[model samples]
Target: MTVLLFGITKDIVGSSTLSLPVSSTSRLRTVGELKDYLSSTYPRLRNLSSLAVAVNNSYAEDSDKIDNFDEIALIPPVSGG
Candidate 1:
């Protein structure tokens, strides 16, 4: 699965996009699982107060299901006035 990173998430990951190997033995099925995997792989991600996941250009909840071909993006909290 490939995930697009935005704002601080991109800075933390050091890339605009991230690729996760999908195998029969280990497949990330839910959005929550993806978050855990990302946080584990990129410890800095865990520091963020809010990290939103978007699937196919739509906001997704923790319980949402994810597929390898899905369009995923990580949206970090934005503050401006």
Candidate 2:
């Protein structure tokens, strides 16, 4: 799956996008699972106040299933004056 990173999330991940494999070892079947995987792999991501995941341009719930071909994005909290 291709995951787009925005704002602080991009900075933390050190990339604008990430290519994650959907394999038995990765087990990224649900949005919740993705979060867990990210937190464990990229511990820095856990420092964010919140992270919102969008699938197919729509906000995804934790229970949402992530298909291998789905478009995913990690939107961290943003602030601007």
Candidate 3:
């Protein structure tokens, strides 16, 4: 699956997008599992106060299932004047 990073998430990840391999050792079936995998692989992501996952332009819940072809983006907290 390919994940698009935004805001601070992109800076933390050092890339605007990331491609994940779908293997038995690193399976990404649900949003919750993706969070766990990211937290473990990229510790900086855990430091963020708020991180929301958007699937197909809509906010996703932890239980939401994600497929390899789904549009996934990591949206961090944003502020504006």
lDDT of 1 by residue, 1-81 (tens): 889999999999999998877763157889999999889889999999999999999999999999999999999999999
Instruction: Provide the overall lDDT of each model, using Cα atoms, as 2-decimal numbers.
Output: 0.91, 0.89, 0.89
Cα lDDT of model 2 overall? 0.89
Model 2 regions more than 4 Å off: 24-26
Best by TM-score: 1
- Candidate 2 C-alpha lDDT tens digits along 1-81: 899999998998899999886673256779999899888889999999999999999999999999878899999998889
- Cα TM-score per model: 0.94, 0.91, 0.91
What is the model-wide C-alpha lDDT for candidate 1?
Answer: 0.91
How many clashes in each structure? 0, 0, 0
Better of 1 and 3 by TM-score: 1
Note the residue pairs that clash in candidate 3. Answer: none
lDDT of 3 at 35: 85
RMSD of 2: 1.5
